[model samples]
Target chain A: MRRSAFRRSRGDAPFRLASTGAGVVLLAIMAAIGVFLVVKAIPALQANTSNFLTEKIWNPNAVEPAFGIGALAFGTVLSSFLALVIATPVAIGVALFISHYAPRRLAAVLGYVVDLLAAVPSVVYGLWGVVFLVPFMRGPSEFLNTYFAWIPIFGGDQVVGKSMLTASIVLAIMILPIIAAISREVFLQAPKTQEEAALALGATRWEMIRMSVLPFGRPGVISAAMLGLGRAMGETIAVALILPATFGISFEILGPNGNSIAANIANGFGEATAVGRGALIASGLVLFLITLVVNMAARLVIARRKEFARAA
Target chain B: MTTVQTGIQPISTGRRVKDRIVQMLVYLAFAIAVVPLLSVLWLVVKNGIGRFDLEFLTHSMRNIGARDAGGGAYHAIIGTLEQVLLASLIAVPIGLLTAVYLVEYGPGGRLARWISFFVDVMTGVPSVVSGLFVLAFWVLALGMPFSGFAGAMALSILMMPVVVRSAEEMLRLVPNDLREAAYALGVPKWRTIVKVVLPTAFTGILTGVMLAVARVAGETAPLLLTVFFTDSINNDPFNGPQMGLPLYVFDQAGRPTDTAIDRAWTGALTLILIVMLLNLVARLIAWWRSPAKRGS
Candidate 1:
């Protein structure tokens, strides 16, 4: 009896320890990522001659190493911001379609199809952007240049298909499924009684949704959009392939002039000396910080939503 | 209290017109979103079908120049399979254990809450950042070579949070009654989890694992930093440069030649097939084992 009791008590110890260890290991890895990247980036920052944040040129491999994230950061933020602007409304609309507009039997299937868009590898998107979308974007780009030339973004004389606009479009498509999927879940969670009450009040379908679903799902949509923005900013392969690799900080998005931090890392890594790799890592660190802030804000919104739901 | 209208009432014409317009816009949004998917599929098939044949499947790019038309992604296929398998090996056990800890052992505990939140944070780490992490720590610090194993380390980081999230969801779905019943039989908590809880969640966990695999298998950026591309095959994941399907597509697409572009399309098509197949199979398993379908 004493032996059996002893066995029972000790039996779960190893299993519990193993699992706790796994969790600790995961935490360690996350900490290590930040620590090691900082360690690797310090030397590169010290080697730089010019302002690392403001200089336009990237000549990190030279003896007088001079590089800056000005152009890369500018392009990354610009393209991702443009992508967010273009994708948010469409993503919300698509979410509404899946949650409220589609026939009941078709909604699940349609949602799955949208998710397939996410499943397409980024490299494949890069290929499609280069071979197909780039050429096809020419007419639209030129049209924007002609009609919207008064706008600073479309004022550039050179209208190349491989421009910031095209990269933003690709990023928008890539992030649409992420936003739509989250928003659809939230839209579907809107109180059924509220929806019914709106419809019973002789409100039209769209008005009913606007009154019932939109308000409840606002936080979710915002969080989803932020997540999508984070994704767009970090997107590497597609932008790397689509952009013409120009190093300039300009708002003329229709011109073939753009380079993002992630794209620069991918494009430059092959030929980079040790210092160049460090510089790229430092830029990646900047991207990491940007996305981290965005994601944390998204999580905060979600946490607030949970509290709101509980109060309701 | 005044009674609301008892009869059917028509909404205002203006309201109806606005509703119709918004409805059309919603449908248009869905249609617009789908165009790229259909276009990508159609174009991939159209362009890739010609080169995705026996020679392409069997041969490697070996000595083939960018202008050459007959080269294949066989080498890349080998590297991707090996790296992904290595990644799965590293990620699955730890992810499973972490999920178990979160759902079974430490629900609502301080450590569990912190792990859960950090896992969410980890999910937001960019794939390229994961690559850079491994490049800094494994390759540079530890002085490891550019090998598929190093690439697998990066891919495994990307894979872990995905696995933990899915697995936690699956474990959470396990009814508490099952655990109680095992406990009533004087079974230890560990055995109950091992023999009872795990078996119940097996198919669901498998589905999650497969989905995680599919996600990491397509990762190119991490592989770019860790694997360092090669045109020839390297069967051993622990040594030397390797090629992955996505990297193959990226490399070939970068080349300014028709044949290289064709090869890139074929590589992409192959990758899509592999990823989609995994997804479909995972969904099928989940559907087959779903409690509602089983009427349990």
Candidate 2:
């Protein structure tokens, strides 16, 4: 290694400089995003009459210039959590089917279909959600509100179709392809020998999958879910189009009250005052932080899996 | 051996039933997963194909009334093409270089690890947040007018990480034997990469970059905030507000008129077709240029 280093080519310097500059540019962009958000948000935070974290009212345009992100954060977390709940099992099932059960041709076709679904843009999804899903969900929302009224999330009297439940369902559809694609790749990577051993032990196909495939795919599925959660939390258009924006916080998802940070920023940015824009940026800062944590968690899981693979 | 043959007994009916049920569930899962995708495509095509004519592709919405049934998305298509081209121009090179560094120069270094981590984080940053970043820095701080270039800055942010991630994967797939062969011939390291490694991975890198472009080209949030909408065609991207396909769809949909609603559907169809076409081309390149395809 030392000898090779001593004999380094003269052309190395410029190439190395260019590549390192590119890498540093990525780091600098991330830092710059953080710094600029903070710098711009300072005045918005100071000019506020109420707590930026606790107040529920958004009146950045008023004489007092008061606002808070409590409701938006709640709605964002609640809706994304629900989306993760809805998407994870379905994604796992689809992944398992593709990796293990489907015929070869069918698996290939289904894989392509999922890739197409991912390629379908978010605005298009928002269009479909508003035109079809909003009306389609009205019946179900009413049913849940009527029959499942014992639950707090379904206890609301009003059954607005454009509610948190509706937004979450849209988010679920948006994230499903990503989680399914990642988990399918992971499941397909499970050791063939282990699967054969399980089958040789007279295990049924389901039992064999349970023993050989799912255990290996667990970490991958967790990371996929985290990634999906990140996507759902940051999703803007679909939620903006579907959810009826209300500043009031409500535990009842079946009611007409839900607003994510991204959705709020998109919906309200047009009519905002200068301070309102800053407050929106501050909300975006929160969104950036949330997604950053979720993505880092996913990366940590993937890193651990790599280490485990190396050890094995 | 004859005695061992009797050890094999017929499987229980319960096990058979379980297997059948599991297999059925698998099929059901596939159907559930596919139904929404097909429905979306179906609805878009069914409603949008009416106005997808040459006139729709060539005329701008400059003076047309919202209720008047005759304007098209020509300006939007032009704006989208220019902005996406600018974004690709800015992002692809930086992304490819960063990927080269990660794969070739900074394999296990601390900076490499940090870069990889931040890129992951960047991957999940909301599109609106990227728009906000640019709005604060470029539009407000630097005093640049809202233009397609400003929108390109945000789009580049979103595109770069995607390009880096995919390009890194493609670069890593270039076998070490090729690099070793180049070095054995006394070629410089940089030449080995540019001539041998890059060429070998060129098709895969192209597909990755194309996919990245497709992903960002459909983005509406960044353009909505940065490029602020315009109705007329603007040849200059660096000067004023520009209309993009996604933003055009959004603006049309928000109008309370039937004609505008129809235009929204058509605009969406155009955008989806552009994106899907990019994806299909990428897939075709991957299929045709795969090393295994040559052997087969």
Candidate 3:
């Protein structure tokens, strides 16, 4: 028995160590991403003749090395924010439809179909955006510009189809499935007892959802939207293909003048000189920081929701 | 009328109307979401059919120009397969082991909690950022050349968190009674996990790995930064630049000619087919082997 115990300890010790080592390696890689990007970005930041944060132009390969992330950052945040705004309510509705309204037999298949939207590669989305969405948007762009010209975003006269609004629309589509999937899962998990109680109180279907399901799922949906926002901000190829590459800090989303940090990197990396590469890395660093904060906040909300669930 | 008047009033018509409107909106929302998906699929199939022939599948763009009509994605397909395979090799074992740790050795322990939290954070890292990191550390700092292997490293980083998350869920679903049964039979914990627990969860773990592979196989940004671009075939991923399908589409689509655009569409079709097939197969496996379904 003593010998067998000794053998078991020896065997178990190595397995435990190997598993622990694997976990540690993952943490190490996460740390390395932040550290390496920062280290590489510093030289480019030092070489910049223009302000790195506020200047609008991106001329990083010039002899003077003038570049800035102001325009890229603006477009990234604005486009992602617009995508979130456009996608959230619709996503919630879709979630409710799946979890509450759809027949039980149909719900699983419908949910799977929505998931198929996410399984399509982003590059395909880019191709579709360029070939189909761009041309298709011209009509809507003209309509918005003609009718809603007073709006700052729709004020541009030329409806060049490859505008920030078009990109944001594509982004909204890309992120819709993500938000909807999470929201559906949360809505499905809404307490059966509470739902029954609301219905027994003579509540209509929508009222019952509004009072019980929606309130229960609110935190989950918010975190899901944040996750979607993070995805939208970091999406590279689709936005790169859709937006006409221009740099400016303007809110005219209807104009063909928008750029994002990731898109800029994808578009510029092919011909970037050393300093230019560094500039792109600097912009990527900013993107990384923004996404990290967003993701962390989402995680915090989710953590809190878990605690709240336990308490309730 | 006075006798009919009770303390409680009937539900308002206004609320009923509101409910009906909301229900319609909910259904409309679903229809709206499906429209773009159908459009994208329809357009890809329509445009891609022009160039998705045997010639396009077998040939490569060695000397083909942007206006040329006969280039294919053979090389890009090879590179994508090789890079994704390499990434899986690097990621799956670590991911599986980490998941085992999270589920078996240290559930809710400090180390496990931290690892779990950071895995979520790691999943949010942009593909471009992972690409940039590989470029900075492996290509620039280590003086390694742009190759499929570097791209694989970037892809592995993206794939790891996905693998861990899914595998961890699968591992958690393994019943405690099974573990107890193994322990009662004088089986060691390590042996129980390896011989019993892993075998039972094997299909689920395989499904998760397949899904992760599908996700990373479609990633282009990391490949753009790490693998660089090549037109001709490069079988050895460690030696030189590589072409991938997503990058192929990106490269071809950037050109102005009709032929290039046609090739880009075909490439997109191929990529979508690959990703969608993986997803379908993964879901099938999950459905087929689900414990609940088995019990039923």
Candidate 4:
């Protein structure tokens, strides 16, 4: 090796610099992306003070430049909420079954299947939703609306085929794999000795899980849910395929609530005018921050519980 | 006698009814989870199988609506291979080198700790965000036109973290005694790493690389922003639009015609098959190279 006269003495400084440099480069890239997005989006945000963050109008044909996020943000959160409510319980149960109850071979098969789902491309899921699934949701949506129309959230929507319900179901399908994988891992990591002690006391299988395993795993499951939430909030193609891009605030799960941050970005980005593109960038920045917060929150919840457990 | 029999039978019947309900629910849940997965696969096999003919696999994209209809995805397949292979080349070395640095040098130092921690943070970055980062840095700022190289760069960004983490674990498994023996023999650090340490962890490193490739192969967003698709094949990476299997799926599904929709299903299946093959190869390599299997 050629002698580096510069680092011949310390020998460690070069490697240290490289390592620290790599770390800084990674951080700098993330920070720079955030800053650039904000800087680029400033113009679009300036043009529409009232509509940029809150208004639901999205008509480019109008003489005035009319655009708003009220509908988009509502759609984003509602679909995510629907996905969370549906996936969380199923994920928890599947995790429980795999880690606690199922036969070893069966559990392995289940795990493989779920992980396989994660590998499915987003566009494929979207196609499946449009071609195979949305048509079926019509009957279900009507059935729910028939009895539960009195409830604001279940009220009838325009176009029974392409509604928030279709989008939400697709989102749920995508997030389930992630949530299940995390929860299964958490369940597996529950203090083995604690579980053994419960079983030794002749606690039935279900009761043992209820008492000893669950409390320790509660934080982990919550973290898993949060991760799933992050994914649901940002999922684009599947939602884009199914949702009608109607801009308004509607509580109905089966109704149009415009399009999500991601769906709107994907839908409008290709054809967007210069100002329109910047607005989409601004919206993208919002989505990015939301996901970042969700991720950090999940990490904090997991980290804090570990700290508390140690202290106790 | 009849009244007693009736009373006993009613109670048993109710208990059986409750048991059946629980059993049915369990099956329903399993079925619910499996339906989407299987139906998607079924669609792919049914539609994609016809498209998987030899000519289709080997040929380039045909012109639009000229009825030359049988050209293969050869260009796309070649592009995917080259990009992913290039990414693997970039990623494996850097990742393995960094991993070695951590394992060999770090006992409990601050620098090592930071590298380890930042890696975790990097792991949480969503794939789309990573795509945007590549776009901002490489395409927008550098004035590099979108190409296969850009897609490879994005893949490298995703591939690096996974490789670093997995290789670190693998390298750490090499016993300290091995290093001590090398030191006693007066072997230099770099020589010891190459001659003694790497041989032991080669299998694991290979596994990590294959998994990384599997991950990046199916990515759509990075390609969407960096190397957008072209209908006709361009073998060159530096100049023009290149197709990938994921992008093919996206293009087909986005249009939603009968023929296009069928093509999307086929592409999805093909992508899945490629991933499965890579995983299988990794597993086989790991098994074959394992010390116990070799009777080492």
User: Per-residue lDDT tens digits of candidate 3, residues B232-279?
Assistant: 999999999999999999999989999999999999999999998898
Per residue, candidate 2 scores C-alpha lDDT tens digits across A102-150 of 8888888878887788888888888888888889989998888888899
Off by over 4 Å in 4: A1-20, A46-51, A58-66, A157-159, A304-312, B1-31, B66-72, B106-114, B188-190, B287-296
The candidate 4 chain B region of ten consecutive residues with least summed lDDT is: B5-14
Which lDDT tens digits does candidate 2 get at residues B1-296? 35557777777899889988887887787788888899999999988999999889999999998679979999999999999999999999999999999999999899999998788778888898899999989987788999999999999999999899878888998999999898888888899889998898899999988998899989988888899989899979999999899988888877888888888899999999999999989989999998888794
Tens-place lDDT per residue, model 3, A187-288, is: 988999999999998899998998999889999999999999999999999999998889887788888799899999999999999999889889999999
In model 3, residue pairs whose N, Cα or C atoms come closer than 3 Å (at least 3 residues apart or on different chains), thus clashing, are: none
lDDT of 2 at B247: 88
Number of the candidate with higher TM-score, 3 or 4: 3
Global lDDT of model 3 = 0.91
Worst 10-residue lDDT window for candidate 3 chain B reads B1-10
| Candidate 3 Cα misplacement greater than 4 A, ranges | A1-8, A307-312, B1-11
Docking tier of model 4: it is acceptable
Best-to-worst order by DockQ is 3, 1, 2, 4
TM-score each candidate. Answer: 0.97, 0.96, 0.97, 0.85
User: Residue A28 error for model 1, in Å?
Assistant: 1.0
